[model samples]
Target: MSTDAKTFLLTGGRAPCTLELARLLYHAGHRVIVAESLRHHLCRFSRAVARNVHVPPPRQDPDGFLSSLAEIVNQEKVNVLIPTCEEVFTLARGSGRFPDHCRVWVEPIERLTPLHNKWTFIQEAGELGLQTPMTWMAASHSKLTEILRNINGKFPIILKPVYSRFAAEVYLLRHPAQPCPALSVSPEKPWIVQEWIDGRQICTYSLAFEGKLIAHCAYRTTFTAGKGSSILFTPIEHPQLLKHVEEWMASKKYTGQFSFDWIETAEGKLYPIECNPRATSGIHCFGESDRLDQAFARPETASLILPQAGVQRMLSLAMWSYGLFSVRSFSQWRNWIKSLLAAQDVVFRWRDPLPFICQFLLLIYFWKQSRRHQISMLEASTYDIEWNGEY
Candidate 1:
C-alpha cells in the first residue's frame, strides 16, 4: 500500500452499494474497514475490508455505536468515516466526539436533519423554489384518513414513513375501499401521504464536497424487489434532472453522498418525490474511474464528472432467484441473460469469492430478523440498521 493512501471506516455493510464503495476505495490502495450491525453480512468476508467489527444498531443504541466508532477511529488512525445508509444521521449527530483528525463524511446536523425527513424536505424544497410533490404528514390512522378526505386528488395516493429507507412500507392506495395500513408507524414515527405523480422514475446518487458537486451518476431502476429495493441499474442521463440536483446540492451546500427519487412527467416537468440523504444503488453504476478516484482522494480539487461505462454491476444471483419469476416476456428474459453474462456480480470478485458466497447466508439472517421484527424481507434488511431520528 502507498504511504499516502488514506484509511476509511465504512458503515452499513448489509448494503451492496456500501460494499461496492469499499471495493472502489480498497482497490485504490486505501485501507477499508467496515462496521456492521449484523454479525454475518457479506462485508465480513470481503478482501477489500481490512477489518469488520460488529456494533450495536444505531437506532437502538446510538451512544454505544458512536463510542465504538470513536474508539476504532483513534486506535486505527482512520482518516475518514463514511456512512453508507441512514446511519449517516447518527454519525453526523455525534461527529464531534470523533478525533479532529478523523473526518466524518457527512453534512452538519443543521443541514442534514431537514433533508432526512420526507415532509420537511418537500416543504423546504418548495420554499427554495424547487418543484416537489404535494405532501402531507399523518402521525396516526385518523390523521391519515383526514388527509385523504381533504385532498381532492385522484387514485393511487403514495404513503410512506417520513423517515424510511429502501422504500419500505411504501403503499399505493388506488380505491376508496382499501384501508390505510399503518404497519410500523406511530406518533414517534409518522408517515407522509403525497399526491402520486405519473411519470418515469429516475434516481440519482451523488457526492459533493463543501457545496460543489464532485461526482454524480444517475440511473433508472428497471427491475425492483416489489416496490422496494432496486434489483437492476441501467446508466442514463437527463440534463434537466442533473441541473435540478446540482441546484439542490448547491443550495444546501451538501457535503456527502446523497440520493433523490424524481418523477419526470409526460410534459417534461420534474417533481422530486423524496430524498435519501445517503448512498443508493446508483453508486454501483460507477466503476473505478480516474475521475471518481480523484473525487474520493481529494474531492475539494476534483472537477465534477460522470461515471464511466463498463460492465454494469448487478446482483445477478438475486435477480435470477426471485426476480426471474416476475419476467413478463421472452425479450425481457433474454435481456436479463445478456446483462448477466456481460456484468460482474456486485459482491463477487475473483480475488475475494468468500464474500460472494457468504452473501447467501444473509438471507437466513434476514429471515430471522423478519420473523423477529414481523416485517417483510425488504423491511428487515434495513429496519434496525437505519436510524429514524424523526422524533
Candidate 2:
C-alpha cells in the first residue's frame, strides 16, 4: 500500500465487477472500503480491502441505507463514492445527506431516474438523435395486443420490464404462434416490446467529467446470457458508436462511470439497447487492453486502444480455472482446453491472482448450489426482498 492512498467506498461489493473494480483501485495504490449490502462473496474475495461494512439491504429501506452510508462516508473520509448496482438512484438521490467534503460521482437525480427507467432512456436517446431500437411500451393486456397488432412484429420480439435490473423478467417471444402468454401486465407497470435485432452484442465502457467523455473503450461480448457476465470478449473500434456516445453524454450532462450496450445489425447499423449508468461487466477488458491504469491515474484521459492478441491467452487462463472444477462435457472441456492454449498469446497480466482465484472458487460454489436447488435464477431477487423489512 502507498502512504498517499486515497479511499473509495464501493457499494454492491458482492457483484464480481465491483470486486474487480476494487482490485484495480487497490493495485493503483488507493485504499478500498466496501459498503456492501451483503457480506457473503465480497468479503471473501477482497485482498487489499481496508474495511467492509454491511449496510442495510438496498430494496428494504433505501432511504435509511443511504443515511447510514452517508455517515460512513464522513467517518471514513472517502474521496469518491462508487456504486456498482441498480441502487445507484438511491444513493444519487440522497447525495445531499453526505457532507460536501466527500465527492460522490453520480448523475443528477433528475437525470438518474429517467436513465434507469428503460422507457425514459429510450425516449431520451431518441430525443438526443442517438440510434435506438424501436420500442413500444404496453401497460395493459389490450395495449399489448394493440401494440402487437400495429407493429405486426416478426417471429422474435423482446419483452422486458419498464424498470428492469439486469435481465429480470425479460423474455424472447420466438414466434408469433407463441404470443407472450399473459403472465402479468399491469397498466401502471408497462412492458417494452422491441424488434429483436440480430447482431453482435457490444458494450462501451466510458467515464465522463462535466458531461465530457474522458475515457472510453468498446468490446464485443463473445459469450453471455441474460444475467451473467461475459465469458469472453474482444476489443474493437467503431467510430460511429463513439459519436453517439459523445452526443449522449453531452445531452445528459453525464459525469461519472457509465456503459451503453449496442447490437450491430447484419446491415451494419448500430442500435442502442440501453444505458447502464455505472460500471459494467465487460470492464475486465480494460485490464486486457493495459488501459486500466490510465482510468485510475487520470479521470480525464479518453482513448479507444484495442487489446493486443494476448487476449486469447487471458481467456485460456480463465478456461484453465474452469477446468479445475470438473467441467466435463466434451464441448465444454474442449473450449477450456482451447482457452488454456490461447492464453499463451495474450499480454494482459493479472497483477494479483488472489481475487481471480477466489472468484473461480465462488463460481464453482454457486454452480453446485444451483445443481442442488439451493438457488434459482428467478429466486435470486428474494435475497433483496428478505431485507425489505430490515431497513
Best model per lDDT: 1
Error of 1 at 339 (Å): 3.2
Full-model lDDT for every candidate: 0.82, 0.67
lDDT of 1 by residue, 1-391 (tens): 7876999999999888888888889888899999988899888888889999999888888889989999999989998888988788888888899888887888767778788888898987898797777788988778878888877555678888887766777898886667877466578989998888989888898898877888888877666777756777766877787888788788877798888888888998888877887888888888866435568668778898787765476787778865687678999888778777776678778887888878889988898889997898877887765767642
In model 1, state the lDDT of residue 244: 81
lDDT of 1: 0.82
Off by over 4 Å in 1: 177-179, 182-186
RMSD (Cα, Å) for all candidates, in order, is 2.0, 4.9
Provide TM-scores for the models. 0.93, 0.81
Q: Model 1: C-alpha RMSD to truth?
A: 2.0
Q: Candidate 1, after superposition: displacement of residue 324 in Å?
A: 1.4
lDDT of 2 by residue, 1-391 (tens): 5665678888876566677677667777788888866545543545757888878876777877888798889898887788777667677667788777677778766767676677888898888876777888988888889877776656478998786655666788887777676657786577889888899888888877667776677777653433534445555677888888888787767787778888898898888887778777655555533645454445565453334433432333333443335455788667656655554312223644455555445555546555666665433522452221011
- lDDT score, residue 150, model 2? 73
